[model samples]
Target: MKEVFLSTRDFPVDEKFGLVSQILRSAYSVPSNIAEGSGRSTNKEFARFLDIALGSAFELETQLILASDIGYLSENKLQEIQTLLQEIQKMIYSFKMNL
Candidate 1:
């Protein structure tokens, strides 16, 4: 998520509050949901939170693709982020499955 913020630092001022904001929110949601879900009392509740996190990961993935298409991110960078997001989603899914 820090990478997302840093990458958006050079975005146009107009986009600062647009694509940049969307990317940040979605990226932040992934880990934030995980942490929140971990604090829940039941595995079922935690799994629900993981589901939300997965959704956020998918959202982030889409935004990153948009960012790349719009030239805000380089293809290589997008690939890197996509790889990480996939890994995170897979880990979250595995955990949720165990629950």
Candidate 2:
């Protein structure tokens, strides 16, 4: 998430309310959902939040691709973040399944 914010710092100022905003919101959503879920009363409830986090992860993935397509991110940086996001997605999925 910090990496994302750092990377986006170089984005066009005009995008502050556009791609940048969407990217930041979705990026924040992933862990925010997980943390929110952790406080739930039941595994079922937590799993649901995990599902939402997974969706946000996927959304973040797409937004990152779009950012790359627009040349806001370099291929190397995109790959680095994508790999990390995928791992997080898998971890979330596995944890949700176990629940």
Candidate 3:
């Protein structure tokens, strides 16, 4: 979402091209992959794409932790975002598995 990109601009400048970039890209990839997969004709292909999206969600989760640990992001500031990402990951995984 464009809203996420707008909000993440508040992250430290040092992370602009590092953690910030990684986090945004990975977060965006999850939904994008899901959409692209839905556009496919086959259930198998859609499931595969959902799996990739799920993986990206996990990747973003790790990056979030790293950013907070390294002080590029505040623990409290990222807590809600981290929780949301985990929820999305669970939803994505459940959908993918049911496919």
Kindly give the number of clashing pairs for every candidate. Answer: 0, 0, 0
**Which pairs clash in the backbone of model 3?**
none
RMSD of 1: 1.0
Error of 1 at 65 (Å): 0.2
Model 2: per-residue Cα lDDT over 1-99, one tens digit each: 677889999899999999999999999999999999999999999999999999999999999999999999998999999999899999999999998
Give the alpha carbon lDDT tens digit for every residue of 4-90 in model 3. Answer: 465577787777888788889898899999999999999999999998998998898798788778776678766877777778888
- Please give the range of 10 consecutive residues that has the lowest summed lDDT in model 1: 1-10
Residues 1-99 of candidate 1: C-alpha lDDT, one tens digit per residue: 667778888778899789989989998999999999999999989999999999999999999899899998999988988888899889999989988
lDDT of each: 0.89, 0.94, 0.82
lDDT of 3 at 86: 77
Tell me the TM-score of each prediction against the true structure.
0.94, 0.97, 0.87
User: In candidate 2, which residue pairs clash?
Assistant: none
Q: Whose TM-score is greatest here?
A: 2
Question: Judged by lDDT relative to the true structure, which candidate is superior, 2 or 3?
Answer: 2
